[model samples]
Target: MKDILSVKARLGLGFGSLFLLVLIISAISIFSLSDANNRFFRYVDGIGKRKELSSELLLAAQQRAVSARNLVLINSSTVRVDEKNIVNNAHRKVGELLRELTASVEAMSPGEERVEAQRLISDIQQIESLYGPVALNIVDLALNGDKDAAVVKINNDCEPLLRKLVEVVTKFIALEEQTSAANVMHSQDEYELQRNQLIAFCLVAAIIALALTLVITRGLDRALGTEPSILSGIAQRIASGDIRAIDEIKTARPGSVLASFGQMQASLSALISEVHNSSNVISGSAQELSAATEQTRMGVSQQRLEIDQVATAIHEMAATVMEVAHNSESAANAAATADQQAQTGGVTAKQAVAQIEHLATEVSNTSQAMLRLKQESEHIEGVLNVIKSVADQTNLLALNAAIEAARAGEAGRGFAVVADEVRNLARHTQGATQEIETLIASLRNISEDAVERMEVCRGLTDKAVLQISDTDVSVTAITTMISNIQEMVRQIATAGEEQSAVAEEISRSVTRVRDISDQSAASSEHTAASSMSLAKLGGTLKQQLERFQI
Candidate 1:
């Protein structure tokens, strides 16, 4: 237990032992006081009380005997009655005293003192029993006016019984005195015994306290490996940051507090020296890192500016491509409109060729009417009128075609001029038909000569029909070529739009790159500032480490 016990445990054990000893001493004192108090009470309630009651019993017996004698002698009735009451009262008092003495004797311990006291009490009671009735009978005899008989009985029975009762009462008194003396001696002896025992225990407690003090003092010295005052001084020095080596620590016991303090001082000195050197290196490295970060920030800033300029140039190029695509789209729409107008002009040329063929048929009828003028000269006049009407209709159709061609814009301008020439030819044909009508009266005399003219007119109408077919073919070819040109223009516009979109995408990518470069530049500035701060903190750490002595 001593091997495992700490300094606190040893101190606690010493204090607890001292407390237990104090408790034992207090208990001994309490027991001694309690015994003395019990002895005093026993004297008062038992032997002492019994002694007083026994003396009273003796006095009552004597008082009753005297009162009984007075009852026989008194002659007045009032005096006799007073004597009788005195006798009864004295007798009753004797009985009360006897009972009280018997109880007190019974309360005593069952030893020789108690046995002798009990024997005396019993004798008093027996003698009182005999004497009490005799005394009372004498009073009765005296109260009845029989004084002679009461005197004779008093001498024969009352005197002898009373003498025996008095003797017992006197012996009981003596026994109570002897018991009271013995009890006083016993109380004194007990008080002396408790006092001696308390003194002896106190001596033992003093010795134990002295021994515990020596043992705890030696154990604490071994645990601390030094004097408490010396150890406190060393701790104060360490707390004040004085880490210098101590000469006394070499003599301290192994595994002791002083030895640990010595080891801690050595380890701390080495650690502080190493930390001081590291702080210098850290400060130099941080300064170099700060310079490098500043250079990186400058490069990032330049890169961001270059990327922004590139993005602006790409945006302008994309706008130019968009304009070119719009122009191509407009050209495609104009080509499509020109193709539709050429197709309409081809349909009008076919109508003009059909009207000329109808004019040729009417001329054929006039030639037949002239060949039969001697028999059908009236039919010749009707045919000439029909040819003039057909020519006027052809002129009107050509004029309508020319108006439509004019409405067809620049693509239809050449077709409009050709329609105007056809209209003028139709008007000339109409004038020729009118001339034939006027010469019809002359042709009835020369109708056989007009047949060759009708054949030449049919040949011209067939040549005009062939020329109109060639015009339709030319119009169809022009329309097809224009349609192909429109498709190519539309494709070119679409390609130009695609190229503009690609340029726009390039511009957006460059914008993102510029944004990223700007962020990088900002980050580089932050890193440079942080490196400078770190260098300052390292210098501060170096200063802090210098405070500890190595």
Candidate 2:
């Protein structure tokens, strides 16, 4: 029975027993109802019908006796014939009733009941036969006019026979009534027996159904192992994330449903542990990257500040070079005007010398011209000294610019090249100024010699004029050198402007780099904070998962 662990088998066995019990109850009820029906029908058909026939026979016998008495008393022929006919009709009807009663007894009655019925029927028959002859004789006597005698015979013989026949029929009717009552009692006894049997069968079926239900229920309990309450409690604990409950779960039977849940808990624990470890490693790597980014940002900021200072120095140098270039341009224009004046002075000196040679009689005029030439020489020397002073000032400015460029390092490399070119131009200008000073001294000496010779001898005037021509040529060459020095200064100014612009661009690039580095540092800080948060979350998750014992 325990081996029948399948649910379908248990249910089928339980219901099959109930169905058989119902079938048995139905069969018993049907049989009891059928037996009762047969008994009721027998009472109506056998005993009841026989009693009714016996009553009819008694009535017919009484009717025939009355007709015979009337036949004997009647005197008129017409009245006598009617009476006789009535007696014959009653006689025939009585014989018919007797025959029907005998048939009823033979067909329906048995044993003592049948014998009693037959005997009563025979007595009726005998009464009917004797009454018939006596009736005929009474009729004959009446026809012969012996009415009193017929009446007396009828009273003495036929009356007693008729009374006896009535008694027998009444007794037979009573016996049929008793037989009907007995049959009814017997039917009730049989019905009681059937009812008791049905009750007994129902009790047996109820006991069997109860026993089968217990067997099936016990089998089901053994197969399931735990009750619904225990299963529900386990499920609730799992839903709440209390995986330790898996250890507490003890199965009463092997191969239970809880084994699958235990496997799931184990798998989940392993996966969560791996996730926690990976999160920790990622957090550490992120923090290291953030620190490196911060250091890079600081280095870029310092570079930006140095670029700014270099740009400022280059701007100042450009301005100073531009001022020097404007001064050099003005000096070049002065030199060109002076050169044209010197050429005019040379022509005038030759004219004066030629006039002196041609007019020896104009000695007083030549003496006054010599004194004017000596004064002009002194003025030219003063102008040369001023030019020399300007050259020295420009040289000093160029030297200062070169020193500043050198201090600016790599950022001012182009400016330094331009400064070196300006310093060379200034040195050339200073050398040219020294040459002009020497030429001016020589020209003054020549003018003095020519003036002294003119005073001493009028024939030396031609030699003095030739010496002044050579001094005029040397002054013109000095003026060209000053113009070349001015052009060089202008070129230096242009290069300085270019260097300044390049420095400005470098400054802008450095500022942009600084901004980008700052932004990177901020981003790295944000990443570090996020990594720390992730580490904390992983720790929390690991702690939460530790509650599970799987």
Per-residue lDDT tens digits of candidate 2, residues 329-377?
7767767776776776677677667655655645655566567667667
Position 444, candidate 2: lDDT: 73
Off by over 4 Å in 2: 75-82, 136-146, 229-249, 255-550
How does each model score on TM-score?
A: 0.51, 0.43
TM-score for model 2?
0.43
TM-score of 1: 0.51
Clashes by residue pair, model 2? none
lDDT of 1 by residue, 1-550 (tens): 3258877898899889888988988887898789788867768567667767877888888888898998887788767788888888998898888888888788888899888878887787777778888898898888888889999999999889888887877787787788778887888888888889888988998998898889888888888899888888988887777889977898998877899889988988887777766675565556556655676767677776767767776776667676666767666676766666676667667766776876677687776766666445565566566676667677776776767676787757667666766767666676767666666657655665566566667776776777677677767767776776767676766767666666776777676766777666666665665566575556578667656765
